[model samples]
Target: MSQPPITPVTTPPPDKGGDDMATLAKGGRTNTLGFILRLLGGLPFLFVGFRLYGVDEMGRFAAAFVVIEIFALICALGEKRGLAQRLTEGIETDEDTPANLVFDAMLVSLVVSGLACLLLITFPAIIFPNGTGSDFDMWMIAAIPAFALTEILLAAQAYRYDIATTVRARAVVEPWVKSIGITAFFFIPALAGGGIALAFLAAIYAALLTALYSFLRTYGLPKAWRPRPRYLSKMTSRALPLIGADVIERGTRLLDVFLLGQFTSAGTVGIYWFAKEVVSLPQKLKTSFEPILAPVITKNLKTGNMDAIASQVRQVGFWIIALQAGIALTLAIPGEAVMGLGGPEIVGGTGALAILLAAEVIASMAVVSESVLVYIARKRNLAISVGVITLQGTLSVGFILLVQHWGYPEGFQAAGAAAALFVALGVASLVKSLVLKTLLKAPVSNWRWPLVWAAAPAVIVGFIFTEFTPEWVEIIIGGPAIFAAYFWVIWKYGFDEADKVLFRKNVAPIDSDLNASN
Candidate 1:
């Protein structure tokens, strides 16, 4: 149960003071590999979920999935982000601190999760007024703590510089379990709807065991490990801010699922969710970096190195914009082909998918801004989150009105939600940029070149590909071209001579303590 944070090295261990360009290239390659593996591994589970559960049941499962995640975030209370920063910043590498802290965090989480599960199990009818799930659903919700712990532990591993464990558990093992379980649901009638829930419990535990083993092997058990009150206090103090931020951020996403559950049926929830999944596929590319980016950015900030942080922030933004844009473009342009594959049952979802994908494209900037805010000014990060949630709620209400005024159609309301979210994302991105710039006293204006250059090329790729190949190939090919264009534009125009010099200098160093932070 003792997990410690470690540093991540990009490629073949750097030689003495390895070159900065080599490290960045290696880091890019590392992220690229993780992205590929996640996409390949996640697809089978997603496909099987679609095929086995059809649309309505899949929607029910998806809604619960989001709800359980919210509960998991509550259990975490932000230790994942907080610990990643603390350990890597080389504040006080007692090593013993993090190892024991994991158990303490797990203990607190166990209590919170247990109490929540008890209420859910015993009072299912009492809590969920606009009931979509039964007592059976409540039981499924019990797995929340273990799953959340698995997530935190994975983050711990990444900070420990053991990223492959995280990738394997999330990308490979979790998906493999889910895909096989979903496939099994097709044959075992007993395993049909609720079975998806049980499968999640099994998968989480399996992943937990895998992570526990990996963490132990990579970083020995917490030194002189024993439950202690003072240790818990220290860890909790560090994580408190993180806890608040995590709650609001995740709560915002969960609010969407919960709101849908209230006014709509599982069937409608399914429709909205199907549209979300289709439109949000671009998110997968960024998801792999979720564990890695925070620590990397935090390391840069520890040295009071604003330039490196700004460079990374802009570079990541460019990549996210290019990739997310192509995905959103493909989904929006050929909405029918995408959801029609879900079969006629979910075909009413095409319009919703188009609107949601549009939202996702705009949301890319907010996605990258989040990392910057987290690393640079954590308290301000909380403020940014509040701003995001406030905007999201405001947009949600107006969008609902739009749907009502537009004359209700099957997917019209969801389309309204997507439109609202898109506007909210734009506001959040601008706010995030300003906050980051102010925090670092750096010119984030540098992020524009990659975006400006990628646009024309992206448009050209979309039009020509739509005319020539199928939507799938368009998805396959369009993303990389846009990304390539963005990278070239950035390397050429985004970086100044001084920027390249800094990039050139940061390779391997004999300074172990500094390298540990890196």
Candidate 2:
């Protein structure tokens, strides 16, 4: 008996543009649930780390992790978005399978990541600009390979429209493991100093394993797979713009932490990092669409279906903005209460929390637009990303120095960084959307008046809770009340017939034959 020939992941027929919407909705619904679970899982780590390890130690951990994550992104080489194009083009040999292409990416990632790990391990200071707690801190560099590989594997799964695997690995497995591992490691007196690093290592590797298992199951073993040096070199060269774009876009978020660690005290960095984590919940909503959107856009581009592509950009853009706006309102309105959840010492970051949440909401268009731009105009997109990050760096430093000159505290400096991010992202969103609109020759703006209507009521609801109720009540009651008010308005007034598909329980299934055959 012989094994079956390998094929790309199953997707709905390209002709039914409606089916594409259905696929997008399914992914969005699944990841929306993941965001909730991730919120639950992530909060524990923040509480435990802030309460037990204290701000200085966690700040050190955040500083180091930022460096490692950036390096990991570089090693992954932008496969998260780029791989969908590779798969869609089927540019490799007819005998070569999707799994083979993935393996080639994995091989390249491993080589680059291995080199990164060695470099970081040697310098160590690059990872920990603010000195290390223990020699075990160097071991955190091990996360680079795992993190990079997990990115590629998860991208492979997303190509197949299997976002549940992503939800499981990222939302369910990674955070919970770190939460549990951090709590567990803290109990051992000797390990307590390095608990955050150890827990992060554990989390990254666990997610890697989860993603690996899913990749093998879905893509199967690559047949006749061999490394082709010339081919891989071409692939890597082509990926340079995407790699730059991914790093620069991600760098905008991490640069503040990196710069803050250089200028501010560890405690200040800790406060800002906590606010960033809280804002990340809404940030994840935009990403929920990225993996799904990539393959959809690639397919549409294949047929020169500019209308379908534009429609998707609008549809997904609205979905992300609507959800992010609701989350931003709920979180930002009671910013102090949310930051207070970390610890009383962390409450000073309330302004930063609000600003970061607003940044996530405003950055929605840039993220969505980039999803298309990466495939169509990657170099131009990369150039714009570079400009945005440069602006963010300039503004962050200037604002921080201005606050210091004005005799404000370090917490105000942290808020200054968040403010810079808000402005830079607003610039990125405006420029990127305009560029995308020009190329697509269609309207791609996600702004709708209902968003204003929804947010206005939610803000009032949140104001009443914050003004009249206890801090605990404001958090416990106000959060839900604000969300209810925001989404209720969005549901009644914002959602049109097509938009409602995101919430529909029984979307017509993809063809069963496609499922079984794949």
lDDT winner:
2
Stretches of candidate 2 off by over 4 Å are 1-12, 91-95, 508-518
Candidate 2 lDDT score at position 231 = 95
Off by over 4 Å in 1: 1-28, 88-98, 122-136, 279-281, 449-518
lDDT of each: 0.62, 0.89
TM-score of 2: 0.95
Please give the RMSD to the true structure for each candidate, in Å: 5.5, 4.0
Q: What are the per-residue Cα lDDT tens digits for candidate 2 across 260-367? A: 988878888999999999888889998898888888888788778887788888888999999999999999998888888888889899999988988999999999
Over 1-518, each residue of candidate 1 has an lDDT whose tens digit, in order, gives 65456433222232221132334434444555665665565556566666666666666776777767777787875766766765543325645456665666677777778887776667654334345432344556767887778877877776755567876676667766766665675577655555666666667777778887776665556657676678677767777667777777566655665666655556666777777655534755544455666666665665666665665566555555555665565456546656766667677877778766666666666666676676556788888778788878777767766676777875776666666667776777787887777776765532454555645655676567668877566556754554555455556765544334333334432332113324
> What does the lDDT read for residue 123 in candidate 1?
63
Scored against the true structure, residue 479 in model 2 reaches a CA lDDT of 93
| Model 1's TM-score against the true structure | 0.81
Task: Tell me the deviation in Å of residue 127 in model 1.
Answer: 8.4
Clashing pairs in 2: none
TM-score of each: 0.81, 0.95
Report the poorest 10 consecutive residues by lDDT, candidate 1: 9-18
